[model samples]
Target: MELNLPESRSRSIRCIVKLGGAAITCKNELEKIHDENLEIVACQLRQAMMEGSVPSKVIGMDWSKRPGSSEISCDVDDLGDQDSSEFSKFVVVHGAGSFGHFQASRSGVHKGGLEKPIVKAGFVATRISVTNLNLEIVRALAREGIPTISMSPFSCGWSTSKRDVASADLSTVAKTIDSGFVPVLHGDAVLDNILGCTILSGDVIIRHLADHLKPEYVVFLTDVLGVYDRPPSEPDAVLLKEIAVGEDGSWKVVNPVLKHTNKKVETSVAAHDTTGGMETKISEAAMIAKLGIDVYIVKAATTHSQRALNGELRDNVPVDWLGTIIKYSK
Candidate 1:
């Protein structure tokens, strides 16, 4: 089937943005999309793309006019032209939340492949549920005039015995992005060589794409403002504005909270989420950070919290950005 897409422009900044299931859906409920929040995020993404004032040259530097710095000489005219036509090449990945998680867990689909005859039915149920959510998300992006195409990992992705991605046919995804269509992918049940079928987490999908696509930024839009010293619900918990990876590719939290064992950190999955939630997200971000790409974990449900994803903040200035930045030290 041929997909109608916007015309492509010159090579532009590539970004991979992930919409967390908890942020976009009432994860505790069954397949309920936070319509208002979803629309808010969609609109903000459109606005960010349309606004040409965003500097695109540097990864993590102040936008100030530094002498001999590419950041200072960024061609605003080029950006304006690109925005007037279409957003830079970008991809969106959303979590399944209540859509696929509940069904998958009940059927034990995450355990690997469909070894049991009963699991065949569970696989179908899980796929159908996730597709429903994908349609809803595509519709939301459509309302914002985004030429969004839905790509199911179940159709094109495979896993090894370890349940990790063995191979995925991303050719169509690349073609779609290059053709100026935003491909929306979601975590779903996929065929596994060893286990039969297993659940692929959205975090895993983003990591895989980052390795292949080599985008300038990978943003995880979640329910919380950013990574915190501890769970935000706890007393005196402070948000960690930035996390720097060491020369050896190891990351450490600078706050003294790491010294205290009494404080509890909330990395548990949501009640309905079968995939490891915040814990998985942090680990994925760490892996991407080791590659020298900056990853931001930010809240997406509110207009105020959408700044980091909007591309207005300086690449190096996470303090001014409204999120926890995972990056390597200079």
Candidate 2:
């Protein structure tokens, strides 16, 4: 079906949050969700949506204005909206976490050819697992008095081609946010044009929605502080406070807690994650930054995350927010 929604690069969304599977679930364990984290996230989301400014253009490193030197022109794009109106509309997408990964891997659901009994059965099983978690999150948000509507990717007409998003009918999603209700989506088992069925990751879903909705900013909530110099579990890991993305899509750590020459970032994915974990988050976050949108990758259930989701990152000139801000270095 043709979505037939009014298309605008301008902001119709306040923010898009991706709840990482690892952060909300015990990834190494099968189908286990971290209940406390989910509740915290739901409450944090409730507070954020309660207050938000309208969408505005995100300013970045505009060398043309300075000519000789680079500078953050409003940098709040350094952090959003053309209308100057006051409203907060949100679309939330969450990862499968420990919920569906094991089932998907066992049934080879990511391969897409669902003709086999194993793949088909695995597809249904995977949905059941992820949706169970979805229901929990929805209930938590509901308990917080946030008007949340769960919209599954499969049920919402989202499909992929060769593991990339092919088509998604987000008309309902748009309508939900416009009507002041949050649309909660999760990483899902989806039908693929090339492969019979495959897993559509939450990271990919966030990018797709950002491209279409152009929210003022995007937030990625995880368990760890933010983007790390290496695996967060490692002894030598350091949190990178800021990242700058070039037009070419390459990224470098701008503000490392411990000064070092190596600007390259690294992250290790869990074995159960069919979708690439931390690495995928950085890559997609860079893409969003390239669109001149600021991205906040922060630890959930923290003062930093609370500040981030509430749109308080750009209050100071030096930008002293605790989290990684993926910025566009144009």
Candidate 3:
């Protein structure tokens, strides 16, 4: 049978997608066996490949916490015998979990978790760790045929003068898009003028990417099944089927531990250590849609990614992508 390829106007309309970590990580509960959830995500991705419902060059990001800055090793030699497809034509970026968590926590460099000022020594330590992590990821991707490059949040030249992601020309990514290769990126530690020092999450990287690529859809395969008005872990929570990015472009902050009262208000909370979360994502989506792009946030563990990519088209949006919508007003 002939495979159904994704329909595209230009067949070259670049799609800068962001796949979340939790969606692809091995769950602790099932560590005894092959991680069923991670396998499921891979199966979905493989299905998408078989169906030809996505771009030929697919970039899969595994934004997990790395061991540590010193231990951070992206050496292809060390990755001996790994599947060629894992990095082929894919620009990959992953966070250093051990490095970031340890340094950030030690130096008190956190947005949601910290209340006190960061010590200058700790602050510099965290920044260096993040930068080193990016370099390791680049090396690994490059060895796997991705030819990846690391872009530091600092020294990248952003208008805000804040070193979140140095707002560089994403032409390399566009070039990758055109050549049917994947470009992977992740969040970096940043020098926030307002906050002094902060960690930027990979979700923030996705946002900045969307701004540049303007893909037909930006899919965020996160841990949860989309954001809930209330914690789905709780009994009374409701899945917010859709959300419209407001003119002001801020998301409503709903704590998983707290009950929500007003559905009408846009809310946001401080991201744990990084500057990315549901709120950050929604805000970024709003900014991207301002350029007429569409965004989809979905749960990766489920079959949603495959369904969303290959499922029937509806109202200019594909089904099963599952997440809140950030629409643009005509």
**Highest lDDT against the true fold, candidate:** 2
Candidate 1 regions exceeding 4 Å error are: 1-13, 53-84, 247-249, 255-265, 303-305, 318-320
lDDT (10s digit) by residue, model 3, range 1-330: 111222332344434445554443332321122235445544454444344533344333333346665453344353455444422232233333334545666766654222354556666777676666555544443432343456554444321223355344455455654455555565555555555556666666666666545556555666676776645577755656555555566444322333645554332232333444565566666777666666656676565655554432225554435555556554
The residue ranges of model 2 lying beyond 4 angstroms of the native Cα positions read 1-4, 7-11, 52-87, 257-264, 315-320
Candidate 1 per-residue lDDT, tens place, 240-309, comes to 7777777776666653345564333464357777888776787788888777778878889655355666
Instruction: Evaluate model 2: give its TM-score.
Output: 0.84
Candidate 2, 25-84: lDDT as tens digits: 887778888889887887787678768532333222222244575662434433243333
The 0-to-1 C-alpha lDDT of every candidate, in the order given, reads 0.75, 0.81, 0.50
Which parts of model 3 are misplaced by more than 4 Å? 1-13, 24-43, 46-99, 108-160, 163-166, 191-197, 246-261, 264-272, 309-322
Worst 10 residues of 3 by lDDT: 25-34
In terms of lDDT, which candidate is stronger, 1 or 2?
2
Error of 2 at 117 (Å): 1.1
Model 2: how far residue 197 lies from native, Å = 1.2
- Distance from true position, residue 113, model 2, in Å? 1.2
Sort the predicted structures by lDDT, highest score first: 2, 1, 3
* Model 3's TM-score against the true structure: 0.60
